[model samples]
Target: MDVILFRFGNFPVTVLEAGLALGLFVVVAISVLLIVVLRQSRSRADAEIRASEHTHELEERISELLRTQSEMTGRMQTMAEVFGSRQSDMMRAVNERLDGMGQKLGQTMTDTTKHTNDGLRQLHERLAVIDRAQRTITDLSGQVVELQTILANKQTRGAFGQGRMEAIIQDALPATAFSFQQTLSTGVRPDCVVHLPNGAPPLVIDAKFPLEGYNLIRNAERPEEAKQAQAQFRRDVGKHVQDIRERYLIPGETQDTAFLFVPSESVFAEIHENFEDIIQKAHRARVVFVSPSLLLLSIQVVQSLLKDARMREQAHLIQAEVGKLMDDVNRLDERVRKLQTHFGQTSKDIDQILISTDKITKRGRNIEELDLGSLEELPSSERGNNQPTLLNPALKSVPAGE
Candidate 1:
């Protein structure tokens, strides 16, 4: 078989055959080269497609990361805003509390200072009065010695008893309630007389007590002397009781019962403890015994009774005053009603005056913008008086206090 199938015009036929072989060889080489190029291009295109897919995946992941970062940034901003607002509120509350505490502290300090100053001033005043009190104590000691001397004498003792009784009576009753040494119709003078309410019988209080016999009984050394002293005390008390009953116990002039005041509580106690029989005899004789304390208590009861009687006597006067008070209250109510009526009238007049004033003010403002020549040129019918005449409600009517 021949290698070349055809040939062109050639100088040598062998060269032409060789050229066709070379051309066929060259065409085969070109086909191989094109196939290699196509394979390389396919591989490169596959690599490019994989790179593009990977790049797309990377872009998506980057976008997601960016989006998460943006969301996180927004949350941080919101959290920051909330924290800032909370901090502001906390600071404001703390400031307000501090202000309140400061005010309270200042007030407490001021009060404490005032109290401390008052205490210091009182302390100085009390110290200044101490010297005067010491001088008064020395004078009181001398008065006590003089009082002891006054109690030693018989006549002075009687006068002292009367004076003490008068003092107790004065302390308990009014000056008009009791009388000193009142004389009865029988030409007998009592130590003191009490005038009672409702024409009750006057009570006579005898200040002379049988304390001398009691003193003898208490001071006796021998038992026979004590017995003798005790008997004398009984006789002395019985005679005194008889004398009071005969002189002071007149039926119409005084109460049937008279009080024998034991000026010394010790003497009164000794008589009651040892001489119960004597007390019974005095009771039978219509004579009552009283210690100073008992006498004061009796006077207090009398004073209370006097107070009640005085109130009963003035009952009509209190009722009249109460009636006057009620009439004044009624008159005050009537005056208040009249005042309310006056106030209502004043309010209504004031409202009408306000309306007139507002209309006048509007007309005044309008007049300021007007031309005088134009106003003069205007027809009298067209130039209506818009300015309202204001009236004072207070001038028309006035309210007076009740």
Candidate 2:
């Protein structure tokens, strides 16, 4: 290294001095480097301060976000609890309503089943009754058919001849005034005998019912057979009338001049129309031939005579009974007058008793009123001491002065 030296006024200079000066210059350069290092450190510190301010601002924003999140979580929990409680209540109410409906439906079904069973039972009973009635009707029809068959036979029809004719005559006549099949002194038995009111001899009625020929005439198929049967029936009727005259027409033994011949109704009609001469012959013999209808009219004539006599006797009885009744009515009138007198006396006694009862009742009412007035005259303090108290103490006080 080479060194150069220069001198200024009032200074000394050397080569070594100049070298020292150069060393000093180097030291100054080192000092300047130190100052630069310090300034850089200060700038670094300023940058660190700015970073810390930014970190503080970010921390405040994070804290605000955390608070908002906590509030939202709490609100969601409260809503969930409220919703659960409301759902539970709704489920319980629905269960109760369903149970009530089930019970009602079951009861209704039972009632309907019982009603249906009762209806079926009633229908069965009605059907049984109808069946019984049908059986009864069939039995009655069979009995009626059997009765008709019996009436159609010959011997059975004859069995009803004289006795049945007498029954029919007796039914037409008065019962107490008529007799049947009476035997007279001439050894003749008439079908019917009637007694008069004055004890006269009985009238004679002979039964001359011709049934066999009439049944044959009705049963004939051809018109010739029917005509032959009718002629035979007519001859039979004539014979029966002539026989009745021969057997029963004794003048004083039967009646004075009349006798009755009771023929079957159809035979009598036929004889009157076709063989009127036969009836005329019977009339000439002093024996009147009579059908059931003529016999009924003759009985009515006799009944009228007997009824008139009975009415006369009953009139006397009624007059005596009426006189007795009048006497009883007079006695009843006297008893009614005495009862009226007793009723008047009883009414007057009742009135006097009622007046005495009223006087006693008035005296009792006056005594009760006097007792109530004495209670009113008591002093309020004395009344309160003597009176009964109610359960509530507030009711013990009465209104002032009354």
Candidate 3:
């Protein structure tokens, strides 16, 4: 539709002109839109092509990556096999080493156990020996204690000395040479009396000794106490010597000298060393203090004297035996001479028989050479002469044994 519009200052406007201008504006706008659309489509197509090329390069790169992955897998499998074999070898070596160590450990343990057992056994044996030694020591200590108890009593100690003296006398001398606990004619008992050879008087031996004073002297600690003990010992020994002289001595029944028997050598030595005056006084009194050894020596001397006396008593018998032996030897010599003479006569007879046998053999050979016809023609006397003599006339004259 056409319409009237307001006019500008210089031109008049109509509805038909407005319409034509409006249509021309619409047509130009449409042309510009179309051109913009075409340009946009071309840009889209380039973008699509570029996208496709990039995708193709990506595909090729992915394929190469897959091939590399497959190679790596194969190498990994080979490496795994190598590692497995090495592990197996290492396991075998470890097992072998462990077994060797175990065997060595077992042997070492066995040796240690054996050594330990042997050491224990040896220790037990040593302990047993020690136990035996300890028991022996205990027994010895008990015996020593008993001996000490016995020595403590005065009467038992005296008996002990007397017993020892008796043992010595019995061992050394014949029973006929000694007497024990003999009572003398004076109604006094002596411990022993040894009979002497060759009509000598019997010797008296007294065994009682003063041991208390000696023990006191030895046990004294102070010098003054020791001096007092020594003086007491001297007095006791002098009194003992005096008693022996007075009690045992007789005019003609006992020997002029008597023996005082000391049981201990230590006491004897102590007296001899420290109490010389007591020994001198005993000697003057004809009393001798004798220890065990000295008593044994005196007994041996007495035995020798007795043996000498026995030899003297048998001297005539031994000489008579020797004279008889000489007579027997002379008779044997005469018998041997007679046997030699008979042997000589037998030799002469044998010689004569051999001579006669030679003559007979010669005559027998002469008879064997004679002729039988000649012997038959001969006279009786000549025939007898020609015949062989079977027995020899000279052989008849020979002795019967020859």
Candidate 4:
């Protein structure tokens, strides 16, 4: 390596030269450093510019996001308001429907309760009526048992028959029209005697009927006992018929045709069915066997005959009343004729008065229709004159029918 030195005024030349060289070197180094620094500065400036551009892009993105968020928030608020309104409407509709259902259910329950009460009342009334009918049937059964016990005795049965005959006769005829337990010609006491009103013969009713043999036959368990009871019934009936014929068939006292009154219709039917020969014998003896119903019919016929006889006896009094009615009718007819004559005379007088009133009214109308203005046109002396020609002589002669 070669070394050189230089010197300048007031100092070493080599030093000055060295300084110059150093300055040169420094200048060169500075120029190099300036170039490196300028390159680094430009690089840094480029990096910073890229970073700022990136930051600017990010800020733009954030602003866009904020605007989008604001738009979304406003939309969400509107949707929430619409949803709340829809929810409120739905709740109100559901509440109204529930209220209506509740009211309808309440009314239906009340109506059903009332109907149940009415049905229960009607059922109670029907039960009460049925209970009353049950008691009535129980009492009727007891009465039937008592009646069966009473009819078991023969003497009591006879007395019962006699009493029934007396009651029936009294119901059919007046008390004076019938007699009970009357002795006949043969000393037989008949159950009933019916008096005829129109001079007819007395009717004798024998009520002593043989029911013991009939009852025995009815209650017989064996055929032989029933046959014997039937035979006894026939004998008893034959004897009773003979007695009726002997005692009641008096031609002068009672009717020639006598009645055998059996109080029980079942007993009379049994006799007719079982004892045909006895019925023939009774018929031959001029004795007619009559049941209670048949006897009542005969009594009704007797009562009607008696009523007809009584009406016949009062024929004179009825004729007298008819005569009095005819006299009253004739007197009323004469009075009506006199009243008609008076009406005719009054009508004639009213017609004459109406004719006179019509004539007076016509004359007064003619006098009122006279024109005073026309009369005033005449002389005043003529209006004041009382002469017939001065007043209106034409009104003095009115027509006859005016």
Q: Against the true structure, whose lDDT is highest? A: 3
Question: lDDT scores for all predictions?
Answer: 0.79, 0.66, 0.82, 0.78
Off by over 4 Å in 1: 1-157, 311-316, 354-402
Query: Which pairs in model 2 have colliding backbones?
Result: none
* lDDT head-to-head 1 vs 2, winner: 1
In model 1, which residue pairs have backbone atoms overlapping below 3 Å? none
Cα displacement (Å) at residue 306, model 2 = 1.5
TM-score of structure candidate 4: 0.55
Tens-place lDDT digits, model 1, residues 229-292:
9999899999999899899999876899998888878778888999998999999989999888
- Residue 189 in candidate 1 has what lDDT? 85
Candidate 4 pairs with clashing backbones: 6-13, 6-14, 7-12, 7-13, 7-14, 8-13
lDDT of 1: 0.79
On a 0 to 100 scale, what is the lDDT of residue 319 in model 4? 99
Clash number for model 2? 0
Over 1-402, each residue of candidate 4 has an lDDT whose tens digit, in order, gives: 012244355655432344445556645764575466556656787676665665566456546655655565565555556656776887799999999999999999999999999999999999999999989989988987776665777787778778887777888898878888778767877778888987777898887787778878989999999999988988888898998888778888888888887878888887788688989999999999998898889999999988898899899899999999999999999999999999999999999999889888888888887744565577777778775353566675776545
Highest TM-score: which candidate? Answer: 3
Model 4 segments more than 4 A misplaced = 1-91, 217-232, 266-278, 315-402
- Score every model by TM-score: 0.49, 0.38, 0.65, 0.55
Ranking by TM-score: 3, 4, 1, 2
Q: In model 1, how large is the Cα lDDT of residue 7? A: 49
lDDT of 3 by residue, 216-258 (tens): 8888999999999998988998999999899999989999899
Better of 2 and 4 by TM-score: 4
